[model samples]
Target: MESGFGTRRRTRLFDDLLALFLAEGFSQFTLDDIAAALHCSKSTLYTLAASKDDLVRRVTVHFFKRATAAVETTLSRNDDPRERVAAYLTAVGAELAVASEVFMADLNAFPPAREVYEANTAAAATRVRQLIEEGVDAGAFRAVNASFAGDLIATMMVRIQQRDVGKATGLSDAEAYTELATLLTNGLRT
Candidate 1:
């Protein structure tokens, strides 16, 4: 069984790997490169995953898991429904802004990594839909079809994740998310 120290060490390693991937992306890095970058043996990385592809997938999952918690924490701090919407999205944008363009491109290119992002997007859409419903019920927002609004936002989010928004509007995913929050709040305001 792994001791507490071993578990902590592994967690720290995962955090380090995630940071490296967020800054530089994983597609270009081999096991040797990652090991060298992390100042650990290849065996150390294998303790986290059997292969580099698995490591990348695990790191992507770690990124989203941490990001979701942060976004939720930001939303919880806002009492107003409108503020909650903006705060949630803005927090998401802030979390995503840490990732470089190369990282975004690499995430899009890798099917496994992209699937993790896609799942998170879907979950975020659901959360946004719930937030919209809360605003409408509380009369904080003008009456709007919450489902439709959520779907629209989700479509834009998917486009941003896929790099279509970047290609067409030259806005990074983070920028697009910020714009989305602004547009959504303005459009829904009573």
Candidate 2:
């Protein structure tokens, strides 16, 4: 049985580690590097995971799980379909705001972590498709080709997540997401 206090402490530690990964990336980081980034000794991190790979997997899964929950929460907050769409995109942007190009590249390079990210993207696309369907049904959005639109949105998001796009476009992930929300709402609104 885990203590309530212990659970919160662990969650906080995980979040701290996740922030490090988002800022610095996982693939290139050694346990010693992690400890230095975390301002702790190597032994202090051992309690979290046996190896760096396991730590990366654990933190990656935990972060994505939290991010998905956050998106769902954002979607639930507003009843208006347009606002829901905006919130969903904005939430995604917010989540990736701290992530750097190196982090994004390393995440994609790691197979387990990449799989988790790809799977989540697919799930998010399904949700976006559903939102578009609902909006069209309500007549608040233009009757566009929902399936194709959904896939396009998903692809756009994946590309945006990549570092090259940001470097080429000179827009931060958050800036890109803001523009995306605007583009979606304006294009979809009737």
Predicted model with the maximum lDDT:
1
Best by TM-score: 1
lDDT of 2 by residue, 11-115 (tens): 887899998888878887899988888787888688788888888888988888998898788778889976778888888778777677677778878987877
Off by over 4 Å in 1: none
Candidate 1 per-residue lDDT over residues 1-190, each given as its tens digit: 9999999998899999998998998899999999999999999999999999899999999999999999998888889987778888888899999999999999999999999999999999899989999999999999999999999988988998889999999998898899999999999999
Query: Candidate 2, TM-score vs. the true structure?
Result: 0.84
- Global lDDT of each candidate: 0.92, 0.82
